[model samples]
Target: MSSILYEQSLSFKRPLDFVFTYLADHSHMSDWAPSVTSASKTTPGPVRVGTHFDIQMRFGLSDLSLDYHVTALEHPQYIELKGKGETFSIVERLRLEGEGDHCHLLYQIEVYYQEPVSKLVRFFSPIVKSSIKKDLVYLQKALDQQPSSWKPTLWSKMGDRLLLPGMLHFSKKGFASAKDRWIGVTEDLTGRNIVITGPTSGIGAAVARQLAKLNANLIFVCRNEKKALIFADALEVEGYPRPRIEIADISSVLEVEALAARLLEKGEPIHALINNAGALFNQRGVSAEGLELSFATLLLGPFILTERLYPLLKKAGEARVINVSSGGMYMQAIALDDMEFEKEDYNGDKAYARAKRGLVDMTELWAERWKEDGIVVHAMHPGWADTAGVSAAMPKFYDWTKTWLRSPEQGADTVTWLAASKEARETSGLFWLDRTPHTTSMIPGTRSAPRHQSLLRERLEEYSQKLSAVASQSFR
Candidate 1:
């Protein structure tokens, strides 16, 4: 009987390590593979070659269970499995490749039927192909939903691989020396009081911790009061000065104003405001302010907060405002007219991308306007960090790309450097990746002007006024 053959290749936004790890776990088959309703190990653990499992699959009204065994295991490269059942046998292979900030996955399958059933297999080939294709699409969607923090077995050593070259380069450049690395310099932050949003977890938490260690008095703003307390306590335990906890929902302009008022009462000059809290919703949702949740969380909220805090930032000497954006901004262009998705279909990923692009534009605008105040503003994409935000939000993507994802410590390294390092002190109105300045992914000649930097000031001022108006109404 002729065997049915299938092959498919897909580009995933996650890292190569993440792909390998997620596919390597037999237990997770049901998580991404749509046809597989459940997968259980027939052998103990460790899916080495020859390890077997039982997988239940549902195709149309027919429910089937197949005994599967790992036929091939090559670390960080490929996995092949074969499933045997009463009258059918199936072979599946998953191949993975790492691309910069993305992963490529190739899935191939073959099926053989019993001699008598072989005659019917030809007619069923299309059905089989359609089912598998549907499965792959579902898998891709599943991965896109995975968070940056999802741990795949293959990513355990990713940090060692990712940092080796960078660390070696830095070491060769004499980064260890205090004088050479600009770690010891204490430039006057006389007017600067930093407001760090989402200071409780992931890159924000790490940045806050590092700032506290540097003896920077910070107002740590977050929604979770208990988590904030825990974080403050952790800092105290680590011998870092405890930053004052300011409870507020950054998505709400009113909360931001209230928090700002409390800080103003303390009479501290605001120097830097790190708008770092962000969300990636897999499904469509709206915030309390009636704005699309991702838009509100990432762009609108930060915009309003910055406007409310602009006076304080201007009062500071050489103040800096760092906006945390994402590389996902490259995925899509700005939907200016339908920014709020009020009249259009909503997609979480596109919503996030739009918000981030807006953020980048806003960063450039603010940097240009605030230049006179010595307030250097910049936006940064914290490298793919292994944080809960990634794991929980994008499990399938995390699983597939975990291999190339950086640890939270490694990801936050650039953010911390931008926030405090003297190397970045003089540099403003730029985007940073891996602690080095880089240009944005914006293409020339969109709805906005061709030269992104040139038009930033005007755009930012316009957006700032709009956001401020929103805040004023919301607060009242």
Candidate 2:
């Protein structure tokens, strides 16, 4: 037999005591591991040295049922486990050290295979090492966040490792080159009521086509009734089922309210809501309500619609809400004080970028608050897509960036994946691309903790409450 050993180290802002307590509990492994589906103790008391457990794992379509015996345990310091299988033997160890307010964790894994398979496994060592390293990074991120009060499980840890990379890579590459591979395999919107804004053109139009093929009952929202009808007619001509059309200028709060009321009156739950409608004005502009155009159309409109339709979303049970964000959000910090840019110099690109960032932030907040209700909210960047909007709004920018841009269909793949895939059911409030969840680059001088997400959530909730009050007063 031949053996392979791997080691990795990660640091977290949490205290060493917290890390030790968390690691000492074997059941917490399931919370961060993507491979281990379920973990349960065979010996009924608190986990300690010599405790034994059975772990269930499913990779792709293969089932791995294994028994693990705890070998060593040193409180606030180290743990070791050994697993024996028909084909292989595995040993795992973890060590923790305290450094002020931070904790450093070290992990080591050793694997041995039977003689006949040893050589083959050695040849695949590079791949395995790479996979394990990536998994560790995800595990670190999940542990750092300390998800809302829930018993830590191995499945959660495994999910972080399995889903983060593809999402990160896709965020960088967009969907053009990877769409066909991820489309049907990752997402299926069949038999769902899918509400989409801006369904007549560009990315919106492409998404409608894909959903039609998936047999989704489509609800198309657009400002121009004639344009919406035309798009609906085209879908029918293309052998798609007739979609319901709702004509309302999303930038107008009154119109948005009426639209929500009409949908609620219909008494049918919306299985998914895609907040895809938005415009980029090269010059400063204001909506009919006297709000900044980008703010009203991109952030406020979607926020209002989502709030009004919360009941329907809850009724859908395991429903999704996808916010189409942008890569540009990374370029600038949000100006919360001047969100409307009324007092400062307002560049369209800056305004658009901030709006997208707000959307991403809100998605995370909503997911954290609503997970128990069975609702999943996700934010995603479509990469650079070659669309009419791009060409019309910034022809020069499009021309400069066209070489890397994807088709509209390509841009929509991740959005569809997050909305319809079973793999995505447990994952929410994260950014995705190419069917994988991704981590955004950290802002300079910022701690790795989810501090930005927390701040955004606070600000958004405050603003939303104000908007809700305004809405109530208007109705009266």
Candidate 3:
């Protein structure tokens, strides 16, 4: 049987040294390569020709375990790797060209199989090629990013063994630096209008401050008129334009509707709508609409506002919607049936997490629904940021790990990055942390089922319609 070959060429805007170093490290392969659960260097010395890698990958439903040997290594130029399994053999090569600060990469793969396996392999060739193409997109993105603090260090490894587990589990700041190299935070936002909720304090305030410095017209949708005015005065003192403050309790569907209507009446383009006003109540409470407070504030409120402002977002031509969720969402999935937590006892933390998870689910859902309408929607977690909200809500936990926490600006870096960067607009419907896409679910039971997408979307639409109808009757 004839050997199958596939080829792809892509360019990385990063330095050749950066590209080569990142790819040459076997451990980084799994970060970009599809279905690669792990890649380890079995050799004792530095990476060079003859170095061996034990790779474990999942193909369809089968676990593929294989050993690959480096056949050739020419720094900043070429690399070739060969692997053999019981039924098949493989070879992959990379050709690199460096130009100024950019690198061009040419990747090629060849696969050969024994008699009966050949038929099966060829039959799957299209799928194999498609998978590689998809993986290459991820690889290119990986190459373009600056190294994050998530890189394993001796201290972190030791901490993993010795330190308290829960302390670092949700703390991205424990691993990620306050600054990001890939996404620039100082981009100009002149002539842009950015609407942010809960800008009086915490991560939302930090995000507002950063965007203001970039010359964006700031609109604060806040509950406390006094605090909103005070914060607006502070921004003006800092030489920022007087921020527009719209006082509305976001948890109230009527207020959310009123806020959106007021903004719509202004006829000004909305460059971005940041749904950042959210809180975890120590006890379960009800909104004006009689929905659970966490659910209403975190998910339903944002949904209604975004839905009402859909036309305005499209008017801006390339608007963005950013949902500020919490890393605490890792523990919960969308419990659609018990979404309001009416059936069981409500744990404050779990209630808060479920609300954030629901919002995250909607972020992805909205991005897909609105992509053709020119709106980019995304969701992100602050990752144990040292903020007043944390101190008040989880005082004991904050007191214990205060030193490990990131500053408000550090935690808001990804949010600011996503808000201002053109690169971030390239892809939508992703959960982000430290300027890169992160997995939405880290635990097995924490992911929403495939069917939950439409169900949640429909539910939010129903809520939006109900709220709009109420607002209409009140007006009449």
Candidate 4:
């Protein structure tokens, strides 16, 4: 297919977020687009920058799936995406404008054919126009009858209980369904200071982006200044305030303590502290602090950081501490006796899961201990998110579940909700997934014993003392 640029413009009486969200979501593509037989988000998350989709369209005697990648996006304002197939490629640009009761949409698309498909390009132009025109009619009709009762439906909840089907809720479809009940965060966070560890990528980056969008004062705890600067620059270019960076390797207890000291020295009243830095090491390794890498990063680092920041959290009044745990923790309980995995073979995933389990237990303990301090502590599982950590640490699992894994944004959703939502403000000490409180343990074997949380607290306290003593000696 040569260059036949197709352009279309439409006006609607709906708000931009409404129209844009509807069009951007690919799950219901077959409902309005005649040629599209099926469509699904191939990537995790809602349609936004970096999201991908697979669209299958039937044309007379042939059908093909076009894999689309979103190249650029500016919220509800503008979007550009490209789709490639076995025989051809396509470019699509969607722009939205106006506000309140009226909105304007400009849709542009172009198609290119390769090799054998080049000869059949002549007959495809008319088909493209007809498809778009028909799509507009059905789309408007569908929008006119759009249901407002998008509040929690029962079928999806049933999916949450079943094992195989429950995995579906970990994908983009689950995020889309969860969006049904979203009224969206109404709070203006202009003066709210939120601290996020590991804000350079994955769920931490996503959560940071959301907070920036809400105008919160952001403080990022990053190990690499270069990556943090690049990420902050991108945020600034996108019209968000550049996040203030605090350098620290959260995987090392010494660095974490120093990071906490610097933050406390500033005396900023932190509205929310998100302990999101973590990694799954494929092989067992120990930090300079002598703690196992996974143990230090996932549990001890966050524990020390949160403990040192207690006064600032109380100063903010009604502060929040959101610990980003993982669904993998459901498989492992806290190996209190062998936290470093020194007695047996070191399987990285199991070590990571155990640390996460301990982190969850500590969350409940902190919530109760700090309840009078006006600091709410909560733990949440991101639910099989596809991130760089997953790809690097568990390639086999990533390859098997990549298509269905939750995007960084989807994984970060509950974290942002816990940080900003009024409903979340009413609760404490719960393990959450998709905005609802969930059981701390799914498997019976993973359940903590009566003394487990106590031991976890005691051990972390011991580590805290060691960190403080080491820091004091270094200062001397």
Candidate with top TM-score is 4
Every model's Cα RMSD, please? Answer: 17.8, 17.2, 16.1, 7.7
- Kindly list the per-residue Cα lDDT of model 2 for residues 32-63, writing each as its tens digit: 45555445556644567777877765444565
**What lDDT tens digits, residue by residue, belong to model 3 across residues 413-467?**
6787788877778889988765656678767888887579789888878887877
Per-model TM values vs. the true structure: 0.58, 0.61, 0.65, 0.71
Question: Which candidate's lDDT is highest?
Answer: 4
Error of 4 at 335 (Å): 1.0
Error of 4 at 223 (Å): 0.8
In every candidate, how many clashes are there? 29, 16, 0, 2
- Candidates 2 and 4 compared: the better one by lDDT is 4
Write candidate 1's Cα lDDT for 273-329 as tens digits. 899999898788877656578877888778778876777777777678899998777
User: What's the lDDT for all of these models?
Assistant: 0.69, 0.72, 0.79, 0.80
Give candidate 3 misplaced runs (Cα > 4 Å).
1-180
Greater TM-score among 1 and 2 belongs to 2
User: Residue 237 lDDT in model 1?
Assistant: 64
- Candidate order by decreasing TM-score: 4, 3, 2, 1
Q: How far is candidate 1 from the true structure (C-alpha RMSD, Å)?
A: 17.8
3 versus 4: better lDDT goes to:
4
